[model samples]
Target: MGGEIKQIFEILETNARATPEQISTMTGIPAAEVEKTIKKAEKERTILKYKTAINWSKLGEEQVWALIEVKVVPQRGVGFDAIAERIYRFPEARSVYLVSGTYDLAILVVGKTMQEVALFVAEKLAPLETVQGTVTHFLLKRYKEDGEILEGEEGIKRLPVSP
Candidate 1:
């Protein structure tokens, strides 16, 4: 990648929704150049979709999330991809990762209530033939998400420094 491309990617990674004009100003590149670079990155799949972060807790809806460790038996002919595809079909599953630990997959799931999440695990996840076992851990609270602090502005306050 070109130096300009790398710089553009770094800026975009830091703030995905940054306007091309802002990027041009920050990186000292022309606005048209920034726009071209962003388009190229999108075409190359280096830049995914831009999205807004939301505080689900502030919306009067309880945010309950879980990390489910799934151990799966790869089918005789099929591979991990097949099993992964099946797991990703559930709307409750927010993210899925193939891991190197004892578990074959680590799935992040979110639900409105504890019971609803449990039902998903019991009725949907466990019944899959490929899935042998699963351990679910409900997140009590989140301190951060995607590098942004979620615990409000209190914890990050800086005290006065003496010279």
Candidate 2:
């Protein structure tokens, strides 16, 4: 890839809402070329989807999220692909990834309530044949998500005490 195209990708990745004109201004590339590059990237699936980093807590919506560390036995020939696919097929599994360390896979799951997530683990996840073990950690709070800070950066200002 050309340096210009790579720069375009980096700019878009950081902020998907960036317009071609804006990118052109930032990168000093022609506006038409910027548009053309972005379109090509979309067609090639390099740019999957544009998203907004939402602060759900501000909305006062109750959302329970969990990160499940799974230990699975890799299938012969297929390795971890088959097992990972099977787990990801469930609608509750938001994101599934084959990872290193002690765990074979890491799954991000969401639910309406804590009980619902617990039920999903006991009833659905644990019973899977390929699943050797799992450790689930409930997300209590999100300080930062998708490189966006949820809380505003404002430190308390204090007046020094007079001696």
Candidate 3:
């Protein structure tokens, strides 16, 4: 990838809402080139999804979130991919990844209520044949998410300059 393309990707990652013209202004690339690059990236699945980070608490809608650490038995041929796919297919699964250390997979799940999330783990997750064990940690509070401050101060504190 060219330097300009990488810059374009960075700009888009930071703010997906940025227009091609805006990116062109920021990157010094022509708008047409910027548009073409973005389109190609989308087609190639380099840019999977344009997402918005939402603080649902601000809207008085509280959601229960949990991180589940799963120990799984990998199938002989497919390894952990098959198990990971089955787990990720559930609607409650927000993100799923194959990780190292004690757990084979890490799953981020969201639910309307605490019980709902708990039920999902006990009923659907733990019972899977490949799933050896699972440990779930409920998110009590979110101070920051997706690199944005959710509460308290948004600006940095700086010491006064001595003249």
lDDT (Cα atoms) of all candidates against the true structure: 0.89, 0.90, 0.93
Candidate 1 positional error at 107, Å: 0.4
Best-fitting candidate, scored by TM-score? 3
Residue-level lDDT tens digits of model 1 in 31-131: 99899988987898877777788888888788689999999998767778899999999899999999998999999999988999999999999999889
The reply for model 3, stretches above 4 Å from the true place, is 156-163
Report the lDDT tens digits of candidate 2 across residue range 1-163: 8887799989988888899999999999999999998888789998898887777767988999999999999999999999898889999999999999999999999999999999998999989999999999999887877676779857768767755
TM-score comparison, 1 vs 3, better candidate? 3
lDDT of 3 by residue, 1-163 (tens): 8897799999988899999999999989999999999899899999999999888898999799999999999999999999998999999999999998988999999999999999999999999999999999999998977778898855756767855
Model 1 residue pairs with clashes:
none
**Arrange candidates by lDDT, highest first: which order?**
3, 2, 1
* TM-score for all models, in order of appearance: 0.85, 0.86, 0.92
Model 1 whole-model lDDT (C-alpha atoms): 0.89
